[model samples]
Target: MSGSFGGQSAGGAKKARIEIIPLIDVIFFLLATFVLFTLSLDKIQSVPVDLPQATPAARPITEDDLVVLQISEPGTAYWNRELISSTEIPRRLLDYKATVPAPRVLVSGDDKARYGDAVLALDEVRKAGITVSIETAFRATGR
Candidate 1:
């Protein structure tokens, strides 16, 4: 025998209902957390420059002996991090040569930069009799 209150059985229980709004909020919060976490894990160590694409693949260089030479569209030149004039290239290369035999210099020219600017940079390096190479992006093989 069951007791009745207001014409309803007292022993009967109501079905539990899930609040969809709160569940959706919890899911969005988790999604945001993962997105922020993934973005923080990527570390990019590179100078801002637009590299030109080339048919030849880019060669990987790990030797610390290699020096970075950056040439922008406005004819600005930077050796490693120090900005220098075109006239200063030979002097700097010579100074480096005295310490390291057969110094290898990597010239990174902006895609929008004048071709003559790159030539001028290379000319100075050649004048100093140093081996120099250019940095280029390898052509993408697939879509």
Candidate 2:
């Protein structure tokens, strides 16, 4: 039973078409959001400078004492006498801290090294839940 119009044909409903304009807009918005977020992360940039001098009493660093972290030339770093990438520092420190009885860290940076690298190392170590202390060499005073 159908309409008796001039030439009427009856069939099922038509399929809906996807609108690409809105999809493109959404993709663009996501791209913009990601770009903005990445740009904002630069605010965490580290400062480069020689730390102030302090007169510290002679304290012996026993074998079980502070763990050493060194930043050497050519962008190489060492943790506890092991060579590891900078990104791996935090995870390694966490693992080390879990096993060590007294977990302490000392960051010693080369004077010729980039200060940002040193700060980043320190930040990672601190985030790993270990106490951090920076090493400063004190020159002998003339009598």
For residues 1-143, what per-residue lDDT tens digits would candidate 2 score against the true structure? 66444444355445457999999999999999999999888566788999889766456556676777876554567676666667777787888888886688978765555688889888888788788988775212110
TM-score of each: 0.47, 0.48
How much lDDT does candidate 1 score? Answer: 0.73
Clashing pairs in 2: none
**Model number with the top TM-score:** 2
Model 2 scores a TM of 0.48
List residue ranges in candidate 1 displaced over 4 A. Answer: 1-62, 138-143
lDDT tens per residue, model 1, 77-140: 6778676766677788888888875478988775555688878888888888888888785312
Displacement of the residue 55 alpha carbon in candidate 2, Å: 18
Reference-based lDDT, residue 99, model 2: 88
How does residue 124 of candidate 2 score in lDDT?
A: 86
